[model samples]
Target: MQQSKFPKYIFDWFGGLVLLIGYIIGSVIVGFVGVAGKFIFRLDFMQKPWFLMLSNAIVFCLVIAAFDFLIVRPKTGKKLNFNFSPTNFYTYLLIFPMMLGMMFIGEFFTAQIPTTGPFFGDYYEFFENLMSGLTDDPVLMVITAVIMAPIFEEIIFRGIIQKGLMNKGVEPWKAILFSSLLFGLIHGNPWQFVGATLLGGVLGLVYYKTKSLLLPMLLHGFNNLCSTLLVTYTKNESFAQAFKIPEWEILIIGIVLFSLFCYLFMKKNKVHYSDI
Candidate 1:
């Protein structure tokens, strides 16, 4: 790992702010273009769900890629570890199901959170829109949500933030904790914050274990795909309802399967975190 000129928090907060500002600028540019097309060309696709989703995703991709390639790399000279190394297919097979269990666990906690106020209501409405039809075009949603997002996010969070922290001589667990906390805060709401934080911790563990970004990116995409499918197809009902299983039974199953898999994985997998 190349040493970073900046600290972990600098990478987290400053880089995140840069991305946020860039997104706003990109949105303004896209909005202006859409207005021109609407008024002059009489095109109305600007309001379409896929269009909005794609625009945001593309802008984010451009901003992050540019920042990493130009700014981050120049300073740290960190290699982008996009390939899976020090690990193999068996680990991934376990991880996929393990994450599904994690999702169930995370959801149970998320459900327990107090989301009763007007503030929570707005984010809930946005989540519903995202699941239902706001990003509803299947192909585009897959391209934007499943593909673009995971690639960039893993690169930034794992490749840049956490790795840089470790390179700066921070303890591995502390680096992961700080990175995961920042990852959650980046999501900007309690609903996403809790789940994303949990997901981040899992991904951080995998990345630290294998020293590769690809593993986490794949898991991230799979997680997003599962969420998308659940909401888009099953309405807002719990997963128990979708499978026609009792809620209590599903919860018990989640806990047991999670415990079993976690124990097995921890026992079976030995970690080599920095072969890259």
Candidate 2:
């Protein structure tokens, strides 16, 4: 890659800022929509789980489209790849376990950190309420979590942000690391940050290797599906606890299986992307 005249941190910072602004704007728009729905249509849109999910999907899609049109397309002169290639289907499947294992490892480490007090506790309650709302409408939750979230997130984080950085002469590792960090920060909480960063790094690697947005989207969707199901069914139990096994055991098993799969995958496939 040719060296860019601009600093790499500019792209990193801008990517995160754009997402933050987009989310704030999206929330305000949704709030207005809810107000209008309540007064004009005699419906409490905020109380409707499906409408909330649809609103979130629309917001994310619009943000992604804006970034692509205003920034990515003009600069790169190429639309982001969204194709579903079967060339790495088996390898892609392995990414699920890899991500899950990473999440377990992250959670284990995060649990060791001392509590940050009432703020963190309140955040947990907020998350629980959010999950409860989703669980109230299982179909909507599936649509939003499994489908919409993955598509929008991958397009923005991997397709637009990460790829754009690389095009501007950012080193592949730096691009992946900063992009993953941005992904984690976007989740807006420490617990989520740790898990998201780990998963995002893996997703970034997959995207860099395959040059396909579809793979990460599918993997992300699968991860979300599993998480949503666990939250819905397990109620009070964490994923590790729900299995009726010790946390350490789960972590050990996850590590061993993930390592084996990664070894097999790396042995079979050579990265084709020169930039990486």
Candidate 3:
């Protein structure tokens, strides 16, 4: 970890700036490629809402990893660890169900938050329209939604940026909060932003506890996959009607249960935010 020559807060600011720029540059490049591919090939696959998202995620991971190895690790004198374990595998048992439940809960608040305009509505509408144009391939959806997203998103957010913040002497809460906030903000959705932030924070805490990027990666991917499944189901009138219930109530239950489980897990694991 490279010690900041500047004040502590300045480290976050500078780190945040670097991360933000890196994210934007990578996103723009990926976006350009996606749009150009769609235009040149007259292919709707490139335009599919999830295609670019998953593709961008993959690109972002690769960029972050390359940058970490070539720039960050060398500068900071830290080695990147990409290990996984059974403990990490078991962690998903808790994360996946709760995240899925949270998605249902989040839908109830959909109208309360800003889901319209430049970042929110337009972003989703863009993807929704693109998805509408593409052929629904379950295999493709699983590959893109379940596998690619978890691997890449985890690498960038949990592995690189979060690790950078922690190494810079940032407090755990602050590190988690800021990293999660950036994660949400970069998504450019006001409505989903809050939920993503909360989830990101939780995932950060998990990462901090387990010291494993794979845990958060699985949680993030599971959350996304659940959302994708829900959207798929809702698209079918019969499926939507059959499962229709007071989702808000379920969300409330999920929140409570999640809180309790998290508390227990943290306590049992004897995990707290300590210097990484």
- Clash totals in order: 0, 0, 0
Cα RMSD for predicted model 1: 3.9
| Top candidate, metric TM-score | 2
Please, what is the TM-score per model? 0.80, 0.84, 0.73
Please state every model's RMSD to the true fold in angstroms. Answer: 3.9, 4.4, 5.6
lDDT of 2 by residue, 218-246 (tens): 87897788777876788642567678777
Clashing pairs in 3: none
Q: TM-score-based ranking, best first?
A: 2, 1, 3
Candidate 3 matches the true fold with a TM-score of 0.73
lDDT of each: 0.71, 0.73, 0.63
Best by lDDT: 2
For residues 1-276, could you state the per-residue lDDT of candidate 1 as single tens digits? Answer: 675333233254566566567667777877887888788989875767766776776676666665566556666575233444536667877777777777776776666666556877777777666555644566766776788789877877787778767766878899899888988887777777877888888889878877778788988999888776776687543577678876566667767867777676678876554542
* Inter-residue clash pairs, candidate 2: none
Off by over 4 Å in 1: 1-17, 76-86, 114-119, 246-248, 271-275
TM-score of model 1 (CA atoms)? 0.80
